[model samples]
Target: MHRSLFNILSGRNTRQGLWGLPLLVALLISLWLTVETTQFATAENLFNLVAQAMPLIIAAIGQLVVVLIGGLDLSVGSVISFTTAVLALDQPAIVLIPAVFLLAALIGLINGLAITRFNVHPIIATLSTQYIVLGITRILRPVSGGTVPEIVIAAVSGSFLGIPYPVFWGIVVIVAAWKLLYGSRYGLHLFAIGGGIASGAESAARNFGVSDRRNIILAYMVCSCFAAVAGVFLAGRIVSGDPNVGLLFELDTVTAVALGGTQLSGGIGSLHGTVIGALVMALLANGMNLANVSPFVQTAIKGGILLAVVGLQSRKKMGL
Candidate 1:
C-alpha cells in the first residue's frame, strides 16, 4: 500500500515549485549561524567559502547533466579524483590542463556507453567504473602533489578586485549553464525525457523514437566535461593533484541536486535551482565545520537533510 501510494504521488511536478526553498533555507541557516559566529559575513570568509565550493559547483554542474538523462554517474567523484592525480603528474601547464578535461569527457562517454550497451543501470555501471578508475589512479599516483602554473592559481584563487576568482567562475558557469541547459530546445527535451519517456520518446529521439537518444549521450558528455573542468580548477587552486581529491564528492553533488528539487526519479530540473542548491550545500558544510561538528555527524546531517526533503516532496505529492 505504501509503495503504491508513493508511486502514484511520484508522478507530479514537485520539482518545478521548489526552486526557492534551497536558497531560503540556506539563507536562514547562514543568517542564524552568522548571527552567532563572527566569520560568516566577512569578505575574506565569503571568499574562502566560494573558493572551497568551486569544485562542488563544478562537479554538480557535470552531475546535473547526468541527472538530466535520467542517469546517475557515481563514477564522477572517482573520475575527478583520477583527473586530479593526473594533473599532479608535474607536467607542463599546457599539456596537463587539456588532458584533464579530455579525460573527464572520455570517462563520461564511457559511462554513457557502458550503461546503454551493457543493459545496466547508470548507478551500478558507474559504481563499477568508479572502483576501476580509483584503483588505476591509486596504483599510478598513490599520492598527490603537483604545481599548477602561478597564473592558473591566480586565476582561480585570487580575484580581480575583492572578489575571488572562484566566485567569478561559479557565476559565469551558472549563467552559461542556465542558458544552455534550461533556455534552449535541447534542454527542454532533457526535462521531458524524464517525465514520460514512452509518450515523449517519439518527439525527443531522432533515431529510434527513444526520448533523447542523442541527448542521453550528450548529457553524459556534458557531465564528464564539467567534471574535468572541476578537477583542473581544484588542481589550480590547490596547486597540486592530490590523490585524495574529490573523495565522496558524488554524495555531495547528488545531495545538492536532489535538494534543489531535481527528482531522483528523473525528468525534471533547473540549473537555477542547482546553483542555489550548491550554495546551500556549501553553507551547510561550512556552518557545520565552523561549529566544530564531528565529520561523521556532519555526514549524518547532510544525508538526513536529503532524506527529509525527499520525504516531504513524496508526501506532498501524495496529497498528504
Candidate 2:
C-alpha cells in the first residue's frame, strides 16, 4: 500500500508527468479557501467558480492538443477575440456560428502551414498570426459592443436540475477532448510525433509512417477551433464582443498546461492533469479575489507561477 501510494504521488515511470503534485496543490488551495472564506464553500460560489473557469478550461485543452506534439499556439487569444467579434456582428446565428469556426480553421491552417511547410518557428508563426488576427478583431468590433445571438447566450446561461449550463458545457467539452486524446488513432500519432521531437529525433515519427507534418497541422487546427468555442461561450456570458477579452489568454493557457505537468518539450501529458491544473488556477484566482488582491498583483502572481513552474522543469525534459 505504501509503495503504491508513493508511486502514485511521484508519478514514477509514468508518461502522465507530475500531475499528482498539482492535484495536491489544488486540494490544498481548496481547503484553505474553504477555511478562510465563508463564501468559498457556498453553493452559489462553487457553481460560479466552475462557470468562471470554463473558458480557460476549454482554451487550455486546445493548447494541450498542440503542446502534445511539441508545438504552441500564441494566437489562440486572438482567435478567441476574433471569434467573439464575429459572433457579435449583426448576423444570424446560423451564419455567425459557422463563420466563427471557419475563420478559426483558416487561422489555424495558416499557422500550421507556416510552421510545417515554411519552417517557421511555432512561436514566431503563431505570434505573427496573433497580431494579424487581433488587428482584424479590433476592426470588427473596435470596442466591446454589439449583441451575440440569443441562442448563444441561452446555451451558456441558466441551469438544468440546479446545475448551471456551464457545467454541462464543461462536461461535454471534457468528454469530447478525452475521447480525442485517448480514444483515437490520431491521438496515438500525436504522442508518437511529440515523443520524437522531444527526444531530438524530429524524423522519428515520420520513419514510422506517422505523417508528422499533417498531424501537427491538425493539432493547430484543433487548438484554434477549441479557442473559438471558448470565445463563443465568453461572448454569451458577456453578451457582446470585446477585442481585448482574450488578452493574455495565451499566457494563461500555457501556464495552465505547464502547471499541469505537461512537458514544454511535449509528448508527455494527461487530460485530467490539464483539467486539474486549470482548476488550481481558478481556485487561486477565486481566493485572491476574496482576499481583495489587486488585479495587477494577480497578473503578476500568475506570471511568477508560470516562470517558477517552467524553471523547475529539468533541462532534459525541456530538451535544452
Candidate 2: Cα lDDT at 160: 93
RMSD of 2: 1.1
Reference-based lDDT, residue 223, model 2:
97
Q: What is the C-alpha lDDT profile of model 1 across 10-80, one tens digit per residue?
A: 43434453566676688898889789899889878888888888889888877876676567888878888
Query: Model 2, stretches more than 4 Å misplaced?
Result: 317-320
lDDT of 1 at 251: 85
Judge candidate 2 against the unseen true structure and give its global Cα lDDT, from 0 to 1: 0.92
lDDT string for model 2 (6-75, tens) is 7766766777877888999999999999988899999999999998899999999999999989999999
**Where does the lowest 10-residue lDDT sum fall in candidate 2?**
311-320
- What's the TM for model 1? 0.88
Cα RMSDs, all models: 5.5, 1.1
Write down the RMSD of candidate 1 (Cα, Å): 5.5
Deviation from native of the Cα of residue 25 in model 1, angstroms: 0.4
The positional error of residue 86 in candidate 2, measured at the CA in angstroms, is: 0.4
Query: Each candidate: what lDDT?
Result: 0.74, 0.92
